[model samples]
Target: MMRYTLNKMLLRLQNRYNYDVRYQQDLLQTDLAAFLKFMAFQSMSSHQGNLAAAPLYAARLRAIIFEDCGPCTQLVVNMALEAGVSAAMLRAIIEHDLHQLPEDIALVVQFTELVLAHQPQADLLREKIMALWGSKGLMAIGFAISSYRVYPALKYALGYGKTCSRIQLNDASLVPNRAAVVAAEAQNVE
Candidate 1:
């Protein structure tokens, strides 16, 4: 979709302008295993949702995390801190959820749980992110990382990252409650 082409352009801009990185370098850095992990996250997209909506939701999540995380160098780390999810725990959760993606195709039943839990209130969230990342120049970083999430989802949809095993999803819903994986993992992924 042409919308996606714009998304690609946006990502390039974030890296080039914000991270001082070249597009090709970002592409090369993606490990097959990590890429697979992101794909699983994508699979959590709407099980009963329109194909388009799932990506939109994923984009929003990326936006929140990236903005919260400081986008350029410490994007992943700060998102984990603000959302209270840890990198290692996030790795484990992604591993779990990707392995058992929703059975159907329309709406991403599983990931809704995650989306709901992680979506932060703008009023409540901005300060913490600012304190950790600074208020000035924190623009569009969320858009960049949210966009980044698509990459892994694409990979997982294609099916990669098998060797990078972890617990995998279960009877549990993928909701983003305060006690949810993201919050609890905030303590640590260990």
Candidate 2:
């Protein structure tokens, strides 16, 4: 039997995922095998260059949202914003207004949602993605969406999850109801 300390586990997670994993760190405390398996899945899904960053971020955001992992959702949002995704686009995604995004990103989001929901449209969407991004790209997208599903289930089942909330990005804060904030700003300007 092997024992893993919290510090070592946190360091490993930070190195691999590049973010805090404290939200589900108890998985390490209780089931090291499950925790390592989740980490491995994440690593496998993290292959780069198969798809554009923007569309990949959009798909990942949709996946985390569908999985209902509040902390994970906020983390991805912050990461995307930091990686140069426009705040407006992130807001649109959070609101499920895919029409506001570019066609490719919108398609990726729609595909992610359908796949996460196990809807029949997922197959058709997969075909479209294959056409647009080729087989390698489609495979990467599928890996990302499916692998991201692991965290929310683990977090929720282990009593480590919460409802999504505002997240900070760079020096700015990302609120859940950004539309309301924009409306308020407009009224103030009038």
Candidate 3:
């Protein structure tokens, strides 16, 4: 059950996005001011695109998967499919097979994983991204990854997030092995 009335603007945005807004509903009910602020921030941040749609979507999906934010991951998977990212690519990401992606997109996913994990290599990955896409492009990628973090945090904090969604449940191994990835990166660094 929702805790507050849906304002006209928010309702319109929800309709347009067609996203499940259970987290937003909880936020709105608990704190209208914060909800409005978050919406405004999202609106402005969403337009700061520097990466191409496909790679950007791939990076976001990677981050969502790393976070184990099931509902959010499902939402991103849907958006990626709608935006023409191949099902094969999405499956590879879900399965943690970064090598299956094209080189550039694979790099983006790797970078996103490092960022989400707060690995030291994140700095090196940023340098690689800058070399490929320049400063603004790096910023755009960072923003894209950062933006997706908010929803999962909100959902978890509000006690609404699940460990895994139905889509992720299709394969029990869909969950990423973050520790293994980090350890491998560390070995490479050493």
Candidate 4:
């Protein structure tokens, strides 16, 4: 068995995906602000001081591993403020405790954990994935999520990311009683 360092593994992932994500060069751009915000938030949320920042990078690391991680991926999810991953998802993986997730979504959640945890006996991830889902299934599992916890939230949050406007409105009539407009019409008829 080979002991794979995180960077070494990431390099392997980069080779597979055909692009290098140079840390400072790739992740420090203005466009990646959303992702950085997400990472900083995750780090704070985890209360781990620094390790919480793990999720922020985990998402991008996933894109590096797979060819087609979504645009919202981690960066968009964070920008949109919908990156709140469900605890249930994590619990489910622990419950199933299987080598691979039968559902495509389950696989990503589990594998993402595996990658993040830097678990050894690593290649076993591919083997179990293959057993559960053939080549096509693996692609489906790697590329999708069971929840839109982030995507839709990203849309609405980003919409409100800037200026806030308020509408001044008269009180809405909840009752069936007509307004003064109705009384004026009745007087005209008389």
Candidate 5:
């Protein structure tokens, strides 16, 4: 009975988001306890902790994009849209149009990239984040960047991850800029 209920809930989420949750379904079928624990991580990923929709989604989309360019990235994009992030801003992020992004979003993107790259330069941006949104804001960004990567990693580990695909925002079909990711990785290697 619990399994049936959970399956229904997963179906609802898949339908609502137009996303593939097959990895989650596999987890549920193979290990109910792990499934529950995995699902519980949503709370950690979603603790906004006083973040406004823009900066919060900025961090989320950036982090997810770094980790995935396929369905998982699309999922975050859709959620960000539902959360009221402007399509233009989202387009800027995905397209890597740094010049076009709004100030706060640009800051979050820079910070997210630095942190993900494990670069000490993030410290300066961290200070900027603290000045703008305080520790709660910093915590929210931290959770978003760290937790959003888990879904794609789990999907790949379970053999359910897909290759990069075009991301759609409203009527616009945008390709994620892999150059930034490649550049970040190159920096890590240096």
Candidate 6:
């Protein structure tokens, strides 16, 4: 009965987001204990605390693009739009046009990039974030960047992850900049 309810809920999620949740379903079938644990983790990933929607979603979208350039990325974009982030700002983040974004949002984007790239330079940006949004807001950004990547990681581990592709937002199909990935890879090799 619990499995049936969980399956129904997953279907509702898929229909609502137009996303693939086969990997989640696989978890449900293969391991009920793990599936329950995964659902608990979702609460952390959805935490925004005191951070406003724009910066929170900004961190999420940027972090997601690093791990996933396909449907999962699109899902975050859709969620951001629904959370009321401006379309233009979303475009700037996707295009890596940090100059055009408002200073706070650009800070979040740059911070997320640095953290994901494992660069210590994010410390200064983290300080700025704390000053603007308080420590809880800073924690919100931390959870946003860290937890959102788990979805794509799980999908890929389950063989449901797809190759990178253009993400559709409104009428425009935008591709996230690959330069960050390249730079991260280059750093990893050194």
Question: Candidate 3, residues 39-102: lDDT per residue as tens digits?
Answer: 7878644654567777787677776766678777877776777778887787777766767878
Per-residue lDDT of candidate 6, residues 66-169 (tens digit): 88648998989888898998899999988878778998998888888888887777776788998999999999999999998888888888899877789998
Please give the ranking of all candidate structures by TM-score, highest first, separated by commas.
5, 6, 3, 2, 1, 4
* lDDT per residue as tens, model 1, 1-190: 5434544665775554443223322333445455345445544431312223222333344333322222221333233334454443343323334333332210122222233346443334334334533433122223333454554343344443122211212232222212243453233211
lDDT of 5: 0.84
lDDT of 3 at 189: 38
Give stretches of model 4 more than 4 Å off.
Answer: 1-109, 115-122, 145-190
Can you give the TM-score per candidate against the true fold? 0.27, 0.74, 0.80, 0.25, 0.93, 0.93
RMSD of 5: 2.9
- Per residue, candidate 5 scores C-alpha lDDT tens digits across 1-190 of 8888999999999999998878888989999999999979989998899898889988888787787648988988888899898999999988767679887788888788888878777887788899999999999999999998888788888999887789989999988875665355335331
Tell me the tens digit of each residue's lDDT in model 4 across 1-190. Answer: 1212434554674565443334422333434565456445443323221222223323232432222223233233232133443433322332333233335444443455444344443345557656755665444433432222333344334541212111111232111111232233223221
Summed over model 5, clashes come to: 0
**Order of quality (lDDT):** 6, 5, 3, 2, 4, 1
**Candidate 4: deviation at residue 36, Å?**
26
Error of 3 at 109 (Å): 1.2
Cα lDDT over the full model 1: 0.34
- The per-prediction tally of clashing pairs is 26, 0, 0, 1, 0, 0
Model 4 TM-score is: 0.25
